[model samples]
Target chain A: MNKFGIVMLYSILLFSNQIFGQFNALEKGVFSGSFESISQWYQDDNKIIVSVPQDKWATNNYLSLHYTFGKFYAGLQYEAYMPPLLGYSRKFDGSGVAHKFFSYRGDFMEITVGDFYEQFGSGLIFRAYENRQLGIDNALNGVNIRLKPSDFFSLKLVYGKQRKYFEESNGILRGLDGDLDIIKLFKIQKNIGLQIGASLLSHYELYTGADPLFPPTVNSYSGRLDFNSTRLTLSSEYVFKESDPLDLNYFWYKTGNALLLNAAYASNGLAMNLSLRRLENMDSRSERTATDTELMINFLPANTKQHKYSLANIYPYSAQVMGEIGGQYSVFYKIPTGSLLGGKYGTKLNFNYSVYYGLDTTFLGGTQGFESKYFAYGEELYYQDINFELDKKWSKAFKTVLGYMNQRYNKAQVDGGDYPIVNSDIVFFDFLVKFPKNRSIRTEIQHLSTKDDLKSWVAALIELNINPSWTIYAADMYNYGNAGEKVHYYNVGTSFVKNVHRIEISYSRQRESLMCVGGVCRQVPAFKGLTLNISSSF
Target chain B: MKKVRIILLVVSVLIALGNQSEAQTVLPNVMVESITGQEVSAMNFFNDGKPMIISFWATWCKPCILELDAISDEYDEWREETGVILLAVSIDDERSLASVKTLSAGRDWPFTIYLDKNQDLKRALNVVNVPHTFLLNGKGEIVWQHNSYVPGAEQELYEEILKLTENK
Candidate 1:
């Protein structure tokens, strides 16, 4: 199948060129693509206890090409994972042409055949997407059509099977989404905007199990409304799913539901946002038996703030797919340049608070999963965080950022571990100073203190940036307060970037950690290795 | 047989490259949502026969914020000198999307912002990382692009814009 795909792709390219060559006007086609390679060579480390893979080296490569001519477009992506990286799923052990599609995008309508990624309003009910870092690519292999008949309404239809690694899942999925611009349709107030959207999705698979009451089909629906203006924005979505007896839910036939609400107001130098979400048995997959980010048909992102600092990300939040309730509120403000706190360049301040808890439920054995009251809080706290940051520019060349965070993470609930809830406080200071000839240096010093689980840690990093192309950095993280062995995870790296090409080389001791992108996460195993990354687009 | 297949693939790619015409580097016609919740075509983002900068960034990316902040400090001078317009495209999905408006407004950045909620434009542009920026000429052709951002990188970007305007 892989060979056929490759052959067919090449054939299309060749055939298209020949067919378009007959017309001089159609010869003006655009070809664009990108290539990326991440390779690692591992070495044994005496300070850490980690089981290295037998290969001792691994590389992941991706090459994608896209061609656009007039209103028609086609693209394909080929991926190769030579002895897949440690902690990556074993399913992606080989190489293949993973994605391919052709589509005609007109002003009023679009139609696509083959593979495509799509999402409904906020992706509450259905979303077919990919996150390469998380080893997730659930692009549907089938047909997709989008129609915009008027200025006020648009509709999308999709029917396909979800992609699982290099193969397609057995289940067939069908989805329909429609959106209406209420303000535009009704010619209402010009100062305000309102929109409404709804989605319906269903999955069907053959039943092969022995359970007589098992369902081979599941259906889900979602509705959303959005309001927008120059200063205020509000949106809400609600999803409901029919009974789905899947492995993730312990074969429970109970229905699923979710709700998400967001509101934001922004004005000169001041902005505030609040988001609330509740998820109950909302996990849906094309393959009933699939688990661990595989074959997911919907996306439910964690509402917590995404941290950039290394230490602050140690206990990142992963959304509880089964049942959880959470909300986050954030505020951003800037002091005027002439104010007392603002010096000459003004100061920026940010504050955020987020919390999550498990759902209160009464469990019933067998096909009946559990029952829970609406808007009730559970006794078990999943996660909580409160953080504040201040950024100040003292001079033209000198700037600093100070931040503090307090967090409580329930290890047993988020990650399947038999451990008590861990509470920690983190403080960090970052400084950047510029020099002549476009040379600059940035430094960060951070400390994390806790009484439980890993005790405490201290980390520091310094980076130098050279104009036009070069960046070098070194960092060290020490587990100083650990009761057991004290270890230092150190890293040094340099990168040279020019135009669309970037090459980076690094040597480091990688601590076992969960790397996440946009709320999706994957565990990376500990190893000492020299890493090389090369990427370019043309 | 494997070697033959490899050779065929290489030959086909070379042929495709050879057949490339002098096509203008225009933005993909993908639909993205404006900050005001209106759907707009990315291809229509032009500066009325002036230079434009389209930057792909996320709220969580520290370097992206730093670069934008640095640009904001000099944006007035840049616009006055080169008549260049900046378009900040937020690739934040539903997770950290709400903060985009707040961050931009709070920072008082003088740039038009759009939301690529599903990352259609990001994928089309083949941007693997944030802080990737493209500089387009008056003809809407992508003339210069850079990946990643370091402190003072905006100076180099300004130089590129100067070169574009000088040519004009």
Candidate 2:
């Protein structure tokens, strides 16, 4: 569908809601519509793996419309692929064709049927979602309901089959979840509140594999509790499941569980939070018969910081779901204004640290020394990071901030076994300065070292802002450590803004790797190229 | 083992140190870039502008982009009619910026656009969803805010913008 058609469709959806008596004609009409197109260039040594030509570029277009009436909002999205689209061929379960419809009604109570997305609890068991630009969608064609009778209570139920790309899985997926505030229900005292939740999911699918085994039905359950007081809070969740066999194999069926905990404390100008999680054999596939990265039934959203700066996120850590244990803690504070340490508008400070390790196998006793559900076999120190920052306002137009970060990366876990184990240490420093004339300058520098690979690297970035409408940025990441491939990765970019629209363009030499989010990752390839960006509202 | 323990200890210290702020606090370092590509620190964006209005948005966020587009159509007359400057920023990644240019140029939006590719501005603003808008006074202090967008939501934004810029 074209942009205009999408807008008209949205207009009609809003017109349907106009019966609510909350919008006028102009207010009820199509408010905004947009169409976006993406052209991706890719190349790799593995033709069988990539599936697309190395020398060609592929593209896709998306058009969407949004409409509203009172508290009701609805949206329609159309994504089209004109064959030879990069990644689309291998990614889609069907030929170059895909389309979806989504809508939501009411704030506290919503029902999404057809091809829709949903997340339950922490999404450990079921989460159907889409990142269209990434060509990732695990949307389910199911009946889902959400009900919140009170501020602290929520209940959700879902039953349907997952849409794997353009095709729907044969398995039937069903789930139930409920969340309630113990304190609110009992009308507890001040400075204290408690919340509890539970969830259950079941999947049924018939299977006839090469091994000639019937697909076993799968069952999963989870529970969580949270307690909050005047200055402290504690939250924890535990999940358990009965594992189905791989290809109806009698040897593969195994039970598993996962545990997560979080605690925090806060006071004037200072705050701290801590989290710990241990997962084992927790993979939940919707089809119940599928394996690996296909037919995933759930998503685990990360609670850590999703950095914006390039170097700081160069080795971003994706959450691991297979089996592992990790924890993260963070602190933030501010010096009082006018104090010795708080020169000018008080100095601000922040620090954070996180670490992940392979699980202890001895505790996980399984048959025939076949690892227990709790055991982790990978190398330790999958990924670790430490960061610090300080900010201050010196004068009316002269604010500044300085920050530094140190990170340790394990390529084995981050790269999904594609690359060898790499123990890397990276350090970064950044500065931001505001000019008196409403202009500003932001600069960053970084260095990375590794002994496993003969590569150490350095990077620098500077962005000049001309206030309210324009900015120019330049950056370079150099591989000073590579023995023979010493190359400088450079990027120069600029952006122009007017009202609700912004355009940003850049050129860069790149390296490719999988962009992982905890345990999930997508392969992002490297290339030498120029890129442009344009975005606006209305 | 010792190193792991030390690292854990440091993390504990950091969390302990972080406990001094208000219970529900915003990340101070998070800032959104304005249409002019200027980084508008989340904290400074409000509390300093002339009763500011901040909206959290994304290129893929249709309702949010639409709400702003509708407001921009009358933004000039609203500015001449009222002096409020509506700032709109895109949460689109660097790769999608080109489309924003062609898309916006075709529509000729009346507002300014900033890019928050990394969502720093979003985290600092304590926004979990797009189409979220915050209203602040000239001192940059936030006063009013709303989440999601309805068809006529711009009418409400205009009313608030007019009130903030009124007689300033």
Candidate 3:
């Protein structure tokens, strides 16, 4: 149906809540939904060399509605991208109903038909999900069934075609996952937990190529184990994929495998966590020709800390889906409130270290691809980061946060460039002061020094917040030591939020950068613009 | 042209149907993981007969951490007064899921935390952003909710809780 028809149908269903409400028997049914829109007006600036498209004004809008009555539930999402934002994919150029689903939940089982998202253990082998900010919604359009025959055992079955932009991919996917909780099944009296799960997934696509050696069907299997206690947790997952030729791997018919291990220990005031991962030819996609965040059947998130500061994000790392080896270790501690260093409110500290490297392999230059030892480390370093932060609250109205980070980024491997490795150091200080009558101000200063890439930089921000409703902020980032034209990226914005609604307006000079969320990265083009964001839930 | 006419007709019919339907108050029934990796229904968060707070947060969200830290200071008192329970739901995907326990433990937060690993519960609840909190009454109805957090906003939340208790 067209956009208008879909809107009409949505409005009808929305108002039907009241129609059903009038009937005493159906009055208990409920309706809930949310709406979000982001619009931007682009302006050209010669200094930054921005490329403004024909449509200077762009917006992305989404409206989702859900209804539930006892064991039955249904929902649909409508999305509109008026020519789409500059950085967004070109495929998302129109508006339509992107998702619709219906489901029923019974005592022992639940079944859903239509669009749905699901994930296997740790999402190493199969994951169908969405991230609006990243412009990714790979929900499957088929049947999803969850069967819980017993309290300790559950099984899930899925069969569908993955969503690719506004349409479904040509490939058909089928998956089954079963999980068993030994502790619960045996009714163990100890204060511990143990679970084991296994998954099997297969993808089928027609092969029209002349090469008969290409396999039209690819299958993968994964197994996982999880153990947890009051103060310690351990989990691991291993996946193996059959030899399948695809575009991402240059049509190589090499098998793929991945192994991930995680361990964590936490007590009253101290905690530590460590994670390790290895990937070998693990780029598993639904479509053979899919590229750049399209029709993916698995997830491999980078095992690195996600820094919150803008300066710290300049060198963010993206997980290498093909082959990589890395791990991260972190520790968090809180000083006692009465200690000398803790003063009155106790001090919080965090330390983290992470590193990644290319796989040690010997290229065979053929379909068989390469060979590598299981425990060998590659000679090329992809990325390394070490960071520390301290948070302290001195009094009722004063607080401060200090942090430092050292990073080594390999532009050649991570971003697909041949530039030299960039080494940088960053330090930041943030202070907040609260005034009477629900008023507060926060300020931050950050400096990043580097010998490569764009050289040294500095940034500052100040924000004023007025009680439960309004906030205003202004920030600037300047490349002070640039060998070329020294540029300053500045932004000013304000936001007003009420019960369930929020509206924000901002004007900024956005530099070309990679915006990432949970290791998924997207490149945003440089442009000066005025932007408006509105969101509400009901 | 015909589509516009049909849309108008539907709009009028919707107006006639009215917009007075009650909003959803009870939490959706979705499976989420406990801190110990056990799948628990989101509906099980309902306390027998006490107020409960459901706060959505992430480890990387600074505002969410600030809000939780602010509440942690006086959580014991709030519990003693209104018999309230707080459930912090971390919408951290697999990338940062391993840190939720360590961070919560390190900060000494006195509240039950759950992991919405794949965001099933997050999507069902229509939560578009972090630091979103819902206040439920003794009967498990969402009495009040707010999005975003500013310093001192916890006082306003406490006032809402006080009102709920006073009404009781």
Candidate 4:
């Protein structure tokens, strides 16, 4: 066995008791936790042909508990995947305590031992976190310390190994961060604010390869400045990394860097924001061989809107970490209640546009990656989005929303597939009507038009809510524009909720699509199944 | 085979539900960000002198939007009657965080909003779902809590808020 495997075994052996040992008895210290279980039983059909499970029943369950006594806190997590569900990585076949941490906080200093999650400024250079839906947890298993002597400045230092699929990666990571509030240091009590921060992170993996061009250690640093007033705010961060090659980048030994700028202005009835980002071979990972979303050291924030509707989510955008430049601008305006545009109640409108293009570069044959010019926009179009929506309340019991979206996506260029370019248009109409004591109904109809890829699709949904207890929803999606075959994906679900607990059961025929939550995308395979989800905390 | 899977799932769920006696809610001392992106402690706002109503919501959650909108219509009245403040905690990560402010402001929600971009506060508070509401007493003890949102759920929250202040 490898050294990292041995260390992982020891960690599990030492903390198995905390995870398995649960008591109903009362104690001095407060204990709290939450449990979530999502399970599916598949019934395969000729349509939506995909991999059938070796295990007919697949379940993913996570249980977390925490104990707190005064100023000290300790927590542990246990995740069980009786073999993983479809689309989830095979590395998650086993179950164990995935995370554990112990922490202490004093007046001026704090210390944490064992496993923990940390993020530097805007997470441009280093961020270790966990996202359950996306099946990502890169928490560092090591020691972290923080100090603040006199409130003028605060400092943080972290050293550990990134968690790679329930085991430690074969890399050692160390980082330091410091933040200073210029306004606070000067004791300015005005509404304006100013802060500056810097972070430095480095990771070294023992790569005893024969190639001399490969570097064992890669270092990166970032600096940021943020300023804000009551009306306007501006923030900018830049990251620079030393030469490092990885399996994803095809082992190209070139320097990597990223720059991000954000600005926002808010008034009484209007809000506007802008974000710009440029990435140049900035894929940083703890494990050299890690691909897909594993062992990521930094997350490139996708500069685009997160669409919630089904038709809108068909072409969600993920940032191209290798090289790309993109920007997003959005404006939200609230029309006056008595104005002409707004009937009795005020109207809300939002307009957003974002686009990305490849960086102009020429690949230099071998160990060296490529060469690029600054501020050069290439002719290669990666993605484009133009969407707008208007929401209005007609009466105390009636509301309506309308949305229109135009999207252009290059599947071969961006997502690394050999499909042709896809240009799509989507429209959404939503309505909500209220009835007598504690009853409401929501309805949505959406349509998408496209000639390439999945062709065209349409969906309709209706949800009924009875206050304080139950909700029932039914939805259907039909691929009418597909020339080969036509399929109707349908789902019927009901949810029962009580004080701090919820249970849901659904029968769904899901089509293949990318589920994007918070700009992160995960591809869920097509399946026809019965699913159950339950969550509770106490 | 299907029957066996169903039986196993039902058994496990029942075993989990059998231990639901105590329901004490305390804010874990995790740090989150305000709407302006400033770091603040979770325990500070929910434990103020007045009765506090802490609601967990997200930008993309439709049920969360319905719940918050339902409450906003009567928020002024609720606050006037019971000196309670509604603290909306959004569990939007970097992906959808940019929309929280615009959505909330466009809807004219009159509540102090904070961002749980990393979900630190949500994990610590054991909130696995959005639209979860927690009512706290003046002393910062959790008085009542509810999960999910139906149209008339705000009535229960109002009644619980009244009960909390009345008990005090």
Question: Candidate 2 chain A, which ten residues in sequence have the lowest lDDT sum?
Answer: A93-102
Clashing pairs in 1: none
DockQ-wise, the better of 1 and 2 is 1
* Estimated TM-score for each candidate: 0.96, 0.70, 0.97, 0.92
Clash count per candidate: 0, 52, 0, 1
Top candidate, metric TM-score: 3
Model 2, B31-125: lDDT tens digits are 45443223355544443345556676764464575466556546767667655565666655422322333234323454555666555355334
Candidate 2, what DockQ?
Answer: 0.03
Whole-model lDDT per candidate: 0.88, 0.58, 0.89, 0.81
Q: In candidate 1 chain A, where is summed lDDT lowest over 10 consecutive residues?
A: A16-25
Candidate 3 residues lying further than 4 Å off, grouped into runs, are A23-27, B1-21
Q: How many angstroms is residue B149 displaced in model 1 relative to the true structure, after the best TM-score fit?
A: 0.5
Deviating ranges (above 4 Å) for candidate 4? A1-28, B1-22, B46-48
Q: Tell me candidate 2's TM-score on chain B.
A: 0.69
Better of 2 and 4 by TM-score: 4
Tens digits of per-residue lDDT, candidate 1, A83-198, equal: 56777788888777898899999999999999999999998898888888788899999999999999999999999999998899999999999999999999886888899999
User: Candidate 2, chain A: TM-score?
Assistant: 0.83
- Candidate 4 is scored at a TM of 0.92
